[model samples]
Target: MRWLVNHKQRLIITVVFYFVVLLLISMRKNSMYKYSTETYTMYNISSSLVVSDPTGTFRAKLPVSHAFINSVYYYPTSKSLGENAIAFTMAIDHHSNNMGHHTFNVLGYNSTNMIKSVATAQTEGISRCQYTTMMARTNTLSRLEKIEIESNGVSVEVPFKLARYTAPKPVIICISPQFAAEQWQLFVMHVHAANRFGGHLHIYLTSIIESYFELMKEYERQGYITLDYWLRMKFANPRTPYFEPNQNVEWRNQAGAQTDCLLQYKEAAEYIAFFDMDDILFPRDFPTYLEEFNAVLHANPGKNYLFYGRREHEFVKASTLSEFSFTELVQSLRSSQTVKRGKVVVRPEAYNSTWIHNSKHVSFATSVQVSSPTLVHVQLPVDKNGKRNHSRDLWKIEFGPLIEKIREDDIKAIEEDIYR
Candidate 1:
């Protein structure tokens, strides 16, 4: 303390302070966990409440950087875009920074040298993010071994694996970001439903409450679905302590993740269906989902999207899949169909991006194409304030050999996780 009071010591201390501050700023790239402690003055934590210190992270820089690419892939959309293409997944940014100017350059290289490249097309001022595509000539991407994209100067490179213009699976299922999702029963039910429909589900895994990581891993091993972490945003400065209204918008920003999923499966999966866990796009008259989609396409030619009107109802969740009853679920549906909200099945190549209910852009290729068929939506999740949402009278379903198709072993595969 006496040394600091001296002018020479004071000068030395000032230089050391700024040197340490600059050092910390430079080391921001490598982040470690944030440690914190809480002492309850009112009650003893050991007796009254359980205290668990999560391996939490430091307050990440809001809007990490310009053009944060969630993912990147080579999409040979020659048949759809009339050329070869490389799709850069959505770049989510802060609402303020999203409006800033952005420049993108996409480069492709073979083993030896840089072969070809293109300027990636970026969206204008959007809400939170903008997805871009780099276009090339027909069948030219087959030789590229590496792909790199530069966004406003920051660049990221990925090892490229060239895929054909076509995808193998006819149907791919996608849902928006799953944040703090703890309903293992609902998750198992969704997986069973997708597998039953012959679809591979893809999800942007933001957060899960308990043993779902293990649960998701098992499903991944069984080839039922794919889950990957997204850089989900957080409300740095929130107005309310609950942050209910702005939480999903700030944290999940599901539209960006959904768009990323759509782009990833656009060429890999012949048909992409965006569904929530509770929504069921069951085949009414046909035996399978593909058959039903094809039938609708044949009936309404030139239409690419099939949007089903949905019926809402309260779904009672069971502990096991064996105990779950689709018959009971159907009997609980509201008699009248919902007007604006419904799930949609689409030809992935048909749209550029999607919203919560529908695509961002309106076209003949969207929900307007088919109108007769509908899906059953189960709204079991309560409101933000934890209130039960009621439904109307019940309606009948075709049932149509679906019960017979249920495999007991497959049901048991997912049901095993519920109790664990």
Candidate 2:
């Protein structure tokens, strides 16, 4: 009886061992990708989605412990370089926390397999905008499926968006907390001028006012504008309150906005012109932006950008939508004055990171300096013959183009009734 009991016990042990082995094998086949690395003490949150704004907008996703990280991005750097790699752009505080305690991470996926990586090869933008960029170059192989970014303790999953690089269409990137509901007239004129010169506006609205939403949508529908909204979250700065501005918030995250545009839209456009909304780049002699850039490229061999000088526009003939045309901006163009600073029109693939005034990691640093294609920075608004008009309702001229059309119809109807 003792021998039979022992035999049964042995049989049970063998079966249990086989069952455990089979279970492990099955799990190994279906598990996420794993590597030996130091993972932080994670109180894991629910996974997030691909990083994009569905209703034509974008907002910052910051870490729970800190608000330093702006975004993580990837480009097939092998297109420009000879290796597969990813580029990261974080809009952290420029003063104290530019590098963000080195806690940010990227989780990449290929269908079901996950590849988590530590950001590497850092580049920090040194600008007075209080907020700047912390860029990284990490080697990667997986395709952009679902991307999750973690900084400090918080991890956010953002929607994935695919964009194309059309070598012919030059995109103008205007980083704004600078735009207001009050500047609708300037915005209208800027769009018309940029489009007429064969350029598309890729505007990032850091602080969105609802009044401008309809106007932005109008241009977006007309195919002249790519509107993106950014949420500032009432923080004076993205980084810890070190050199936080005591005044307005316009200059807060400009460095981050600039670098983010380069990474996000490098594949979307071949040439990118960086300037403020009011600092319009009016091309001279050449009909379109392509023609002007090509001419400059032909003139300056080995350079990847055209750095055009700027001019100051103090006033306009009228702020009325019909009266202030693209031609009017060109007519008021002041090119003779010596520009203190100029803006850049660059091939984004040639640079790894950027600032409001300059770009970093440029393989080709030599750029042509031209004086004709002036970026006219509108300093103030006036009515007639360059006189300041403080009472000008430039912002209140009823419904830009649409109202003008309505007014014309109303006038014709009145005249017809009188005659009849």
Candidate 3:
């Protein structure tokens, strides 16, 4: 009994040591495990179409849930309305391949058991082509309901929660004179069409060669071009003109005839979009680009500033005898719109100085440098006939699929315009 009482202090010390060790191990596990609150939006469609959320437009395609008769998307239940609306664009893709009927739907719900609201639209036949469409309530929706879309053999139910809506910012276009004058003219036409249809566009035109001065004057006179500013030097050479600033215009010293001229002007807005003079802008769905831009900006505001368009380039051998042979390029262009691998970093500062060396050439400087939230890069339709009927003698690389969005009611009308 005397020995037991004498060892009581040593026994207590042993127990305390083991408890401290266990506590340290528990702390390490808690630090090692972290849960990300990052959420995403997915479109629940009735048709067998590719749907995705660009909230984080990573180059690698993220896994998306597809809704069959019984399967549905449940992850986006608590996301905000801005994070919930599916950016849907219709296309002619799978027309020749799938050759099946399909319908499109956007659904929202708080949970799998509870049904919210389902926005459904049916698109049928090889006659319907792919174009940009927004999945939103014609009227405001309260709390997420159940969404059901019926098309072809597929019926999809997507459950999404009702979060507050975030309106998209305006699109700012960077236009350089290096693009063909005729193509620029066509671009202006598309810009006008975009402004009238869905969203607003700000055009930044940098005069490189003196040849475009006349065209600029004409555009300005027509109200399509707004002069922001100009620069002048004390000893003006015959080749250069004096710098002038107009309230509607902003100008700077000429950096010579470099391609970076328009890129420098990217600072004019929160999101800078690129379009060659020859690219065509579709009538609607332009707001989706801005919405994607705004979402990225919201997530990584003041962190990054580079944006690039995801496009499919088609190389075709043209017959030297006929300009009409080039019309086939449009078909080649449209076929390339499917999602592909490779990341597009949106660095406005880097994009201004660093040109894409070639397709598939992504360097670290552009990728790692300046930060920008990404926007959706929708592939546009290409004219296959190679008719070369347009102004640039170049085929139309449609830009509308990536930018402008059309009303659901206007989908058929826009498709008819493409055929006409």
Candidate 4:
């Protein structure tokens, strides 16, 4: 003991050294392994959810569109049936300094939680954008598992969930035209002048035409109204193939136009109205027609049909009524004094298929120039002094009491904007 006391410095040094070694051993077992992290950092996963360990990667949910194979043009397994549809794709990036050889597998889960292996792939790429080979499955697949990755003796694992898939919707197309004509312009001016009497009278021909089309287009866009112009012709010369309607063909032309308009709507629409170039329709006319049309359709769900009504025209002199559109009126008139009268109203036999042409008994009844309406306001032209123009022979009949009533009704409820 006396000799040990003389070498106390050595004993102190030995005890201190033993204590330091003991502390380091305890930290290594209970705490973190202290190596140079600069050489190898933990796996930094890029995903929606936060990962607990920087070195370890966790699962992410896959997008539905990319996961599913849309159309299988060619498949290795089947030649005739083509490729069965699969759900979507899952993508992951391995960003590390060292290239890795990795193994991956895909799995799926239904409403009930049974997991099944669906696909597998392997990759050995050298650089960035060099991805581990994709795992593809022929069947509808959803979830994925990154089962293994090997680089420097460490294996990383990740699992991605499959999301629901959906397809895109189809599109529709439109093909109706806007309707306007010279007669509408003339009628509007006369009525506007009739009430107001005088203004600058600044009527730009182009502006009037444009405004008319604009009005028609607005109505058409709302699916409330449509306009049509028709022409009929006889072959003037076979070699030239020149076509011309007879001298008295305008009325028939109008009818043909109306029939053509109805054909475009046969598939989707239930009712169609024929408006003559000379007929002045108030704005309410559209809504009223639609209402009446729907009522007719409601009564008889899906039959090729329509309802006929009397046409009432208000002249400069007095109110008059006719069951004919203006075109039909022209056909009815031989001279102002001579009017051939019959049941003038007609419901077209679905466009491209009017039965009027086939029947020998029906004269003055053909495509574009058929059908009468509930109202027609015949405002014949007048001179500067307000004396009515045109031959009186053109309009000779005084409408019966019932049609006279409708004419009066239309006049009372007419609005100024409809003329505009």
| Number of the predicted model whose TM-score against the real structure is largest | 2
Cα lDDT of model 4 by residue, 1-420, tens digit: 111223322111111110000000011222233332333223222321211333233222111101111111112122211233121112223232111332323233345443433432222122223122122233322222222222222222323222212111010011112122323434442233222211111111111233344544564454332222221122211221011112222222222222233233323233333333333222222234344344444555443344232243433321222221332222222212212221121233332212211212233323222133333444353232456555744665454332322233444323332433
Candidate 1 lDDT, 246-335, residue by residue in tens = 132333456556666776666677788878766655565665678878888877877888887665544445554466554443333343
- lDDT of candidate model 1 versus the reference: 0.50
Model 2: per-residue Cα lDDT at residue 210: 43
Residue-level lDDT of model 3, residues 1-420, one tens digit each, is 011223322111111110000000011123222322443333433331223433313122112111111112222222222323432212112221231323343433345443333433222221222211111121113344565443332344433322212212244444322311223323333444344433333343332223344445555575554433222111111111111111101111111111122232323334444443333333222345455444554566464443343343332333322332223332333223432332332433333222221112224432322122222222222233445335422534433222223344444433333234
Worst 10 residues of 3 by lDDT: 16-25
Q: Find the candidate with the highest lDDT and give its number.
A: 2
Question: Model 2: residues >4 Å from true position, as ranges?
Answer: 1-67, 76-78, 81-85, 94-105, 121-130, 148-160, 163-168, 173-175, 207-212, 233-250, 317-319, 322-338, 360-365, 384-420
Question: What are the TM-scores, per candidate, against the unseen true structure?
Answer: 0.62, 0.64, 0.30, 0.31
Q: List the residue pairs that clash in candidate 1.
A: none
* Candidate 2 RMSD to the real structure: 19.0
Candidate 3 lDDT score at position 95: 20
* Clash totals, every prediction: 0, 6, 58, 25
lDDT of 1 at 129: 28
Model 3's alpha-carbon lDDT is 0.30
Q: Is candidate 1 or candidate 2 better by lDDT?
A: 2
- How far does residue 275 in candidate 4 sit from its true spot (Å)? 3.4
